[model samples]
Target: MTPRIVILGGGSVGMYTALRLQRRLRRGEAHITLIDVDSYMTYQPFLPEAAAGNLEARHVVVSLRRVLPRCTILNGVVDAIDTSRHEVEFRPHKGPPRRIGYDLLVVCPGSVSRTLPIPGLAENGIGFKTIEEAIHLRNHVLGQMDLAESTQDERIRRQALTFVFVGAGFAGVEALAELEDMAHDACRYYPSIEPADLKWYLVEATDRILPEVGPEMGMWTLEQLRHRGIDVRLRTKLESVKDGRVVLDDGSAFDTDTLVWTAGVKPNPVVARSDLPIDGKGRVRATPFLNVEGYDDVFTAGDCAAVPDLTRPGEFTAPNAQHAVRQARVMADNLLATIRGTRRRPYRHAYAGSVASLGLHKGVAQIYGVKLRGALAWLIHRTYHLTKMPTLNRKVRVLLDWTLALFFRRDITALGALTDPRREFEYAARTTAEPVAHV
Candidate 1:
């Protein structure tokens, strides 16, 4: 009987592990199945570019079926993992829930946007995590511009033009920068709306932003944002966003139609439902070798697992794309070794550095004791991500997009209607009727 292996969450870790394992395992010796809520794995590092229309949204995602031809792909959400029975119950995009038993299991369910119980946030705030969110944000920003232009009321226009982004991490910073660039360039098309007319605000609860790039780089980022006319408010918290009115802890209040939330993410909630041991933070506890603690047959990694950082004693690895991609390789190798009855190597990778793009030709990077900023850093940032993007096809497409962008203006067309495409149809169905039966 062929050994059955089940991998959950077809994101960076799951895809990379399946790709590596497929190349090493003998044909017919093992059957590998990958399950994910999305059929494609998004390279999240490029999300800002995707949001800004610098790279087409489709280019940043790798199709699981295309990339892993030898491995079985199940597009579904795992409802529960019953390790006691070595079975996983999942609900597909369609049809009823089903179960699949496996000899070995790997969990890499990834993370979801971490949100707080701020008033009006659920109804008003939007997250900048998934590809859909990125695309929707692009459209939403442009739609706000349209609203501002169409309305004569100062209050309405001001609210429409005001954009508030909470969190100053890479996602929030990069997203705000890229969208501002796009919005500024798009101003040329709108005779009434000057780039300065749009108010952009970046609020952070902490004293600084972009903590991954070091304090110096973070400071530089803050300065750059402020220089671009963005109101960078640090050491501030969002008290409430009740009914489009934003209340800050610093005794400030404003009404804005756009509120972007990119604060951070928590491990997928499904991890807690599993039979595995989860840490206090709701993450699966895994050894340095990527195996679940006290379970040899189960392995976990990526944002869902608290894998001990061997390089830094008494700490788990940071939840980021860099570590997820690298850890996948080690996890696969260790799993293979376990199957082959060989010594398994512990995962050990030093912190290389960080890179972030501000906008089109602006960025900051720190790698190997080398600190770079401005255009050079931007080039390096793009080049590194281009090389890291999943397949050669996607890389070529993304490169072509950048090359075309240099020649053409930014695309600022908003497809806000796409969010509710069925609205018009439903309205028509309600308002209009087919020709009544003839007399």
Candidate 2:
């Protein structure tokens, strides 16, 4: 009988693992099944651009079925993994949860947005994780501008125009910058609102922003954002957001219609229940070879695995796309080696540094100890991600998006209705339809 191989999470690790495995495995050697909540893999780096209208939303996500033709794709959630039985409880969209057995298990469920218990945050704060949120944020931000333009009440207008982002990390900074740039460009169309009327605030609990970049580059990014009239409040905490009223620990308070939460992410909570050896951070503990500690049959990688950083002794690699992609390749090859009874190699790659896009022609980077700023940094940021983006199909689409963007004015159309396409129809059907006589 062929071995049943089950890979969890269609993220960087799971997708690449299955992709590489499908290419190498002979028919009937093993049955490969990959599962994810989302059918498409989001190129997360381009999310800010998609939010800012620099790239079409569809271009930033790759269809899993189209790319992984050789593997079985299951769109659902894994409720639990029972290592003792080599079975996982899977829950499909329209079916009751069921158990699926596997001979080999690979865990790579990615991270979700880390949020806080602050009041009104759950109700008001929007995350920057999925492409859905990105699109909604774009429409919501522009819609706020429209509200400001038409509102008669000054307080409501002010609240609508005020935008507060509660993190200074890459997602928070880039998202704030891109939307701000787009909003500023959009001000020309609003007769009543000027760019200066918009209030943007970035609140960070730490003194520095973009800490993934070196201290120097982080400081440079701070200065750049501040120079653009953005308020960067460091060493501050968001105390509350009750009723759209943002309260900071520093005794400041304000009302805003938009509050973006991009503080950080914890590893997928599923790791905690996987019956695997996980570290203090709730990440699956793994050997340098990317195998679960003391379990040769089980493998893990990407954000969910705490694989050691070989370059830096006694430390784990950062959970970024750079490391995730590299680790996936090594993990996949190691799995092949295990199947072939060959030697498994350890995964090791030095940190290459970080690059972030601030807006259209604005960015920052520190790659291989070389620092870059402004347009040069922005160009490098685009080039690096473009090369890293999976498949020629997506690469060309994203490239053409940029090429066409050069000749086109920004599209500021608010697609808030995309959030609920059936609202109008439902309302029309309820109000205009003839009444039912026999219920």
Give the lDDT of residue 35 in candidate 1.
95
Q: Write the per-residue lDDT of candidate 1 for residues 387-424, one digit (tens) a residue.
A: 89998999999999999988988888899999999999
lDDT over C-alpha atoms for residue 357 of model 1? 96
Candidate 2: list runs displaced more than 4 Å. Answer: 433-439
lDDT, candidate 2, 1-439, per-residue tens: 7888899998877887888888888888888889899898998999999999999999999899999987889999899999889899999988788899998889999998888788899999999989999999999999999899999999999999999998999999999999999999999999999899999999999989999988999999999999889999999999999998999999999999999999999889888877899888888999999989989899999988898999999999999899988888888888888877899999999999999999999999999999999999999999999998989999999999999998999999998999999999899988976876886
| lDDT score, candidate 2, position 287 | 95
